[model samples]
Target: MTPPLEITPLPYHEDPLGYFAVLRDRPGAVLLDSGRPTAPGGRYDILSCDPLALLEVDGAGRVHGDPALAGLSPFAAQQALLDRLSREVPESDLPFLGGLIGYWSYDLGQRLEPVAGQARPAVTLPASRVGLYDWALIQDHDRRESWLVGSAARRDEVLAWLSAAARPAEAFRLTAPFAAELSREEYLARFHAVQAYIRAGDCYQINLAQRFSAPYAGDLWAAYRRLRKATPTPYAGYQAWTGPEGERAILSLSPERFLECRDGRVETRPIKGTRPRGATPTEDRRLAAELEASLKDRAENVMITDLLRNDLGRVCRPGSVRVPTLCGLESYANVHHLVSVITGELAADKRPMDLLAAAFPGGSITGAPKVRAMQIIDELEPSRRSAYCGSLGYVDVRGRMDTSIAIRSVVAEAGRLHLWGGGGLVADSKGDEEYAETLDKIRHLMNALATPTNDDKWNKKDLHLVDRDIDIQ
Candidate 1:
């Protein structure tokens, strides 16, 4: 990359998120990697996120164009990155390399694994971003968790620590089967009705949600044993921790990226389309093919991509934004998704928070004209989305940061568990298929719980057809 850009030194200990923050304050892109940290048990009984990385930007919005150098030793490698940025600043007139750091795991799937042989001095979750807080004392309100700004003591610990600190670990039950919200036909009918309104230009995309409930209270930690084996996503794990008010919250599986900024550059990936992996190879191929060929998925992805570009344009240099890839097929353990990638150069005058404010929740997950979609989602879904649509990652002491889209996840709370699923709504979606998609996501969660899979668990025939991406749940 450009001789490593120099900003500042990282924390003495492992602080993946903290490193990002520090890098942001200076220059250079900060590469972040989150390694796996299992619980005291041989295998972690519960976890929230898999593992991930964040690439920050410099003031000139320059890029280093390498993902491998991040694996080099922290000391020598960081110094090198600084040297590169130092050189670039003069020529490009940028303040980029504020030291680069990474928090990574070997796998971003079922469980978090350590990077192979690279960490000469390994460590636990970073102390910088976690801040000092009483994570163990928090409550578990699984439906939707929020990002609670932490206090001093809560610092050094990871969110998963909440599981161990759970007041009564015995009470944690990941699966709580809830009553079906609507008859199949009825739900479908509402979906189509909403589509008609969308066509009328009254709204853009609306998020339709449903709530599941059970007489007994439980959460995802109890459900993940089987799910881990069946489908392990670095993002599938949980972020169970106590909030500032001392309230406990558990985030379900999520696959979206909200906002991440480093040095002065930033990026976000919002997933807008999905389809479940099939039961067999042939079926899986067929499903994947259908997802790719389906106009719905393409339309949804492009719309979101355009929306993201506009959002990025606000913080980036003129003509510095572009789509690196679009409508690409991404395969995960339990599902097949159509995804796109967008890149941009940040403006010299931009602040990290401005990137977030411009694109708080990702457009892919929320839909165009995000606020309208959110209002509709609130009306339909059963639970409060405290953190389902929020982000999870680190803001290094340097200023660089990376957060994820909380999808395919569960929220563990006060003896209760909550899981969520959603996508874009368009004209031409089949009511049955759309309704089934939600179940497909929930099915993955139930499978994670080690529960028997139901082919026709929730009936959707009563819900009449709306439009494509049949939301209005």
Candidate 2:
């Protein structure tokens, strides 16, 4: 029998970073942050550390975690193992009490479908990872309250860990400013390739991207703080785990929600079009309005929305899938996006994992006619998207789940920081405009990292740019 969880009240802090700072050094510490302090319309923040069990899938579609489940399929192994640990705990209104929290790499889609052997696996990592946790600290920002959700014994253990003085960590800095792997000629060549494909009726829209990497040292957590300050998002999260190559971390500041399933109701908000926020308020409104009214942007948004509706329909009850909002204007700190909301009800026999499997990499990121677009993406892109377009969130024991599209995020591993910027390209998309949009998406993030955290100034000598020509195609 599993121990039931108990909810205990604690001092509400607007920022959850202080509590996370205490547990960060511990193995498997994860924070699903709702950017309430800076982003509008965030409600809850969930924090947890030290999972009971871990499940990871490698690039070859091999499952690695429990010895007994070595031969099982990735999704099947997750369902079986997670089902065993999920017991009847005390009911709570919080989104996540204790369950699996981690990331599903965009490359993981290769396992679900037969789209492979095109893109080079430049960044090696697990296709998917999740940790089974027995305890969590949940904060409801709307109510201005905090609670520790876990067994009585676990509560005491966590409280003691949180009470201990936090350890000092060195300030993080980029040894070299970020540099692009793809040059202008390379991007234009790919852009024309995508347009050619679209003209041939191979795909409607394809999301193309370029990678930027910078060598860095010191505490990645400090860098994450700097990033969140620069671009706070409602679906932000931080998760770190020990991989084959030492410690790897995901620092996410995303504005798009991939999927949310609660009480059998499913919802997905897909962001398609983007325009950088203007320097002034009047300019900002003009950019936002322009995004809302652009026919090209609206068409892109509608195509992805229809694709997501079909995705949800695969695992949802018949006649339950619908799109309530289309091409809705959403203004963020750095850009204005045209977002669409799609809703559905999960079938009685379906589980959250099934829903996730049906919509793994998300339609918005992959474009219309999902699998075909992914093939084209693989054929053109130089490197595998390790976690850029993947989903990052949690699946609790109670069947509630929420995930964010892993954009505006960075992956830190092996003394290198990897960032990606991309946009959906349509038939009418201009090469110059599409090229500029790709850089516009992540320019603020790079600028933020270049800025110093405290009194320590960046040495100008260390900030030299390095550009490499990648001819992967």
CA lDDT scores, all candidates in order: 0.45, 0.87
Candidate 1 error regions (>4 Å):
1-176, 182-186, 215-227, 242-247, 379-383, 450-473
Relative to the true structure, candidate 2 has a C-alpha RMSD (angstroms) of: 2.3
* TM-score versus the correct structure, for each prediction: 0.59, 0.96
What are the per-residue Cα lDDT tens digits for candidate 2 across 1-473?
56877889989999899889999999889998888777876788889988898889999889898999889988888777777764677667889877888889899898887796577777676888888888889889989999998888999999999999887656788876777888888989999999999999999999999898887878888888888898989999998767669768899999999999999999999999999999988998899888888999999999999999999999999999988998888888899999899999999999898999999889989987899999999999988889889989998888899999999889877778888889999999999999899888988888777775455355543442345643321
Question: Of the candidates shown, which would achieve the greatest TM-score relative to the real structure?
Answer: 2
Index of the highest-lDDT prediction: 2
**In model 2, where is the ten-residue run with the lowest total lDDT?**
464-473
Q: lDDT, candidate 1, residue 372?
A: 61
For model 1, how does the per-residue alpha-carbon lDDT over 134-164 read when each residue is reduced to its tens digit?
Answer: 1111111221122212222332243323224
